[model samples]
Target chain A: MTVQTPGLIATPKPRHAPALRLRRLQEISLGYLLLAPALIILIVFEILPIFYGVGISMCDWKTGAALGVEGWQRWIAPCVSFIGIDSYTRAFTDPAMWHSLLVTATYSLISVPVQLGLGLLLAYLLFQKVRGQQAFRVLFFMPYITSTVASAAIWAFLYNPDKGLINSILTRFGVPEIRWLSDTTGIFQVLLKPAGVDLPSGLEGPSIAMLALIIYTTWVFVGYDITIFLAGLGNIPAELYDAAKVDGASGWTLFRHITFPLLSPTTFFLLMLTVIGTFKAFNHIWVMTQGGPGDATTTASIYIFKQLFQLNRYGYSAALSFILFFIILILTVFQNRFAGRRVVYD
Target chain B: MNRDKLKSQLTNLGIHAILISGALFMVFPFAWMILGSLQTFHETTLGTFLPEQPMWSNYYDAIVAMNGAKPCVFDPAAPLDILTREKGCMIVRYFFNTMVMGLGTVLGVLTTGTLAGYAFARMNFPGRETLFKLLLATMMIPGELTLIPNYVFMVWFPTPESWIATALNLPNAEPHNWIDTYYALIIPWIATVFSIFLFRQFFRGIPNELFDAALLDGATHSRFLISVVLPLSKPVLITSALLTFLGSWNALMWPMLVTNSPEMRPIQVGLRSLITEAGTQTQLLLAGATVTIIPIIILYLFLQRWFVEGISNVGIRG
Candidate 1:
């Protein structure tokens, strides 16, 4: 080089050559190709269907009819002529819809708290280093895995007033038989009769049939909550309990200070899930009650379903669905804003 | 001090007793279903916990009935009439249909989800992040929102509208009604956002170094994915597959909606029909339930460790 062979010409370094852009492009293309099947299906089946639903909600679409011409002109145009929030107005004014909402809210209110409470109690007991812990866990979890229809069928039989095991057992103990599924008598009224307390007529509460459903629902889901709590318990460091014991904290104090705060995240998660789950409950009602005994068990979901399928009011059903969606969204957002802040992530 | 300790021990024992009783309350229904399944028709109605004699024949009868077997009657006068009748239990056919649908859904989910997940995890590409975020956002939209539109689509997709029938010189297309077909059950479930999201999270946790090293050795991307990534992701794969299978196997609504004929019904819907038909046939219903549940229970038993681990993993990630 010093001898001026190339007049300060630099030698090319092979390692320093830019990686092939074509190779990177090929790699990315291959990745796209690999992902395309799922992406395409999701877009077609799920995402497109959602947008289509919104569009269908705008127009009065009927099943088993032509779209955009005859069917639209007949059913949809007239509806739209009357429809600037008219469907929503009808939904609000309709007492059946309001009753359904009330039923759903009350069901959620009663069922969610009871499930969480019982589940926590069970989980806490199971968490103790006891013999046959695994067996206990399996037994608790068994119901969660069973098919909803099967469980409902079993519960339906159990609640039979005539020859049901429950009524038979009650009779043996000199207690009055209950009309479990058929009775429209509010549980409060039934309780008052036995307790010699007169509840106000309006404050009779959820019907006995609805109460049976609530109990069944709570029973089925307690295992799921227990599983969650058990996981949370497992995550809590043993050292914290050791430290608390050393400082003379025990029982309620340790639970309140150490356990509750640490478990808050799990609790929040469960609550959010439970709320969403309760609102969207369909299978149980569909299988067991079919929103029956004068629509006492009919939640918003069943109402929406009936509107669409049975009544052929697709637009109205869609409107109800969107309204329900907003309710869920608002509640979830509110929970996230308030409760989520309290959830300490360790 | 010793007396106080004894008192505490006694209290603990009492607590355990209460907890054990509560556990019994939780588990009794399933136990009852099992026992009920073993009992005769008479015992089932009586609600007896223990049968005087377990009728193992009930299971055989159920199976024979499920298989559409007719009782061979010794009636020569109406021999042909009896011979042609299909009297086997329709439950067996429904069970088969459910299994096919469940397996189909599991396969579709696994294949589609795994590939998509691997791409999301390993590849750097344009719009990848945006697309994933969109997928996650779609999950927020409840399934109820799309129910009507989907039903409409199922009804109307292949068939031409009345207006279209008049416009074209071609004759109006026959209604290739997709309802009750395997397509209706299989197509809608093929794309599951939850499965995709789950698989993506699991795949992302996999190390990139192995893939890179494989690539450096001149292996292609597909080659590396198949040889390297697939081997490492067995647990997650099993978890996803099992979850997908269970969800499909237990599904009641979508199948119920689409399939109108009892012949096309899955085991869940069939069981529902059975419940309605013979509301007092507790033993038969329990027998049906036992058949429905045994497969899942066996699956869970074998894969208990994986299920617990996978569920916990999902809880953390999801």
Candidate 2:
């Protein structure tokens, strides 16, 4: 699930009294009337659109010119022919699309672990009693709350190859300037080139540009993950630590045996979320790199966006969205089946 | 005891070091942005930490540039009409536009969410359970998947006039221009499931006797909602309003897609064009970024207590 409405509500006494009362004409009418406005808006705007989306995905729909100026009329009376799996098959053969999948997969693969691991570590670091900790929390959480475009804009300037702070710092250490966001060279390939090591074509890791993007992503979300983890840490009864300490449990031992086990559920949740977040990350990527430096950072979301908005390929974008959807669904299911069981609930 | 004190001191020092450094790292981009905004265009990429001379004029120019083609100034010293004008003062206009969208979204969400949430929690309705479960299920659907279809619908959905005319056997009627309207920005965003879920959850906390008492007093459901539930749900209401306002305020993709004209565009759109369109104008771009984020930051700072509780509760409850 993208969002979990997990908090339970208190069960009222005399359950379904209102429900039973609804057998009367006025009561039933009131019930429907109460729900009608919200329901109508939701259905008309959100729910019906999903079915409409799937319908569009199946049809060989083009721009408004082809489908008529008032496109909803086309939906009323049919004109477009059903493409029938053509979009999906075309996606399979399309190299740019496949490479985009690779980039998105790699981004998720690299960024999720880094974010989760560092986020967990930071959570532990801040979980300790510290002076002015609240200030730190506010500062760290700012990025998560701030507009991604603004954050990405700031980072874009920071990642400037010629004058960015990172390169500036690197120069002070007597290192040559390194192209940050502009560098399409795979990090591994760049690292290995001095030693005359060459990897095969497909195994060349993610580009430096992607790494820059990932770093920005990590910075943006690390605080969020830390905040979540801090809450998780707070949930662990302090008595466990106290009792364990009384029994001669050291910091490492307590964390290893008690804290780690108890915190696994939150850790797993953040991990899954970070991965899902990476797949959907767009505003930052769009603002920062536009998935650029020669398609080195083009994630599936960005690719789908370009198709729909830039190329006017609505049907194709819809198809790509479904493909991405199935991938996420399958991955989520896979994680739930295999990895979710490892989470130790408190 | 001395050893333990020393160890604790060392640990606190270590914690402070790490926390402070991390905070600095997180905050540096914002600092840099503010600094960069004040620097001249050439000086921005000079790898300087501070501006040679701070220029507030970047902000003035950014406003003048984005405030539309009409020449305008926001100077308080300027005449009242200059401040009030909509033509060339697009930054102000977009700012107002975004605020309207934000307020409209919050109101729509609150009204609809409370109604739906109340009905679901307190009232009995046919298919209510199924509809709610369906709502929850729809939550899983990726919002990006709905983008194209929603866009198409907004652009070309049958106008109410056309539909009514057809039903009434009238000759002709024009379609509603759903896109680039206040409705476009505010309508689709109103049915926020999470907010509805939140209201419903909070509503469930109200004791059954409250409703029973209200019923005894001849209060209708709306009356109960207004007099009792709404008054009691200040925390949830504030949190919901803040979150919805923030979401709508920071909205980039949907509004960018729907609104094409300058006056209709929001701050986020203006901020994006400030970067993508006028790429080399780093000072103005950074200034635009700073200006764009300042409102939310101010709001967040003001509501820090509730916002923190909201954030923590969201994660903890999840």
Which candidate's DockQ is highest? 2
How does model 2 score on DockQ? 0.45
TM-score of the A chain in model 2: 0.86
- Residue-level lDDT of model 1, residues A160-251, one tens digit each, is 78757788889899989888888888888887887788788689988998888888888788878887888888889999999999999988
Tens digits of lDDT, candidate 1, B236-282: 88888887787887888788877887667788887767666555667
Give candidate 2 regions above 4 Å deviation.
A1-35, A62-78, B68-71, B74-88, B118-130, B157-175, B204-228
Residue pairs with colliding backbones in model 2 are B67-B88, B67-B90
Tens digits of lDDT, candidate 2, A1-346 = 3321112112323674564344345656777777777788888777887777677677676643475645345433362578877888998999999989998999999999998887887788888867677888888888877897888888877878677777888899987788888888888888888889998766678888999988898888888888888888999999999999999998789989999999888887777667677877777788788889889999998898888777867667878888887787678778888888988886
Query: Residue B25 lDDT in model 1?
Result: 76
Give the least accurate 10-residue stretch of model 2 chain B, judged by summed lDDT: B79-88
What would you estimate as the lDDT of candidate 2?
A: 0.79
lDDT of 2 by residue, B1-318 (tens): 999999988988887888888888899998999998899888876888788889999888777666554467556555444435452376777788899999999998888888888888888657888988878656556566787667777876555666687778776655556777888898888867777787777788799878877776767777898899989988878888888998888899899888877768888988888777567888888888889989899888888666666555556554
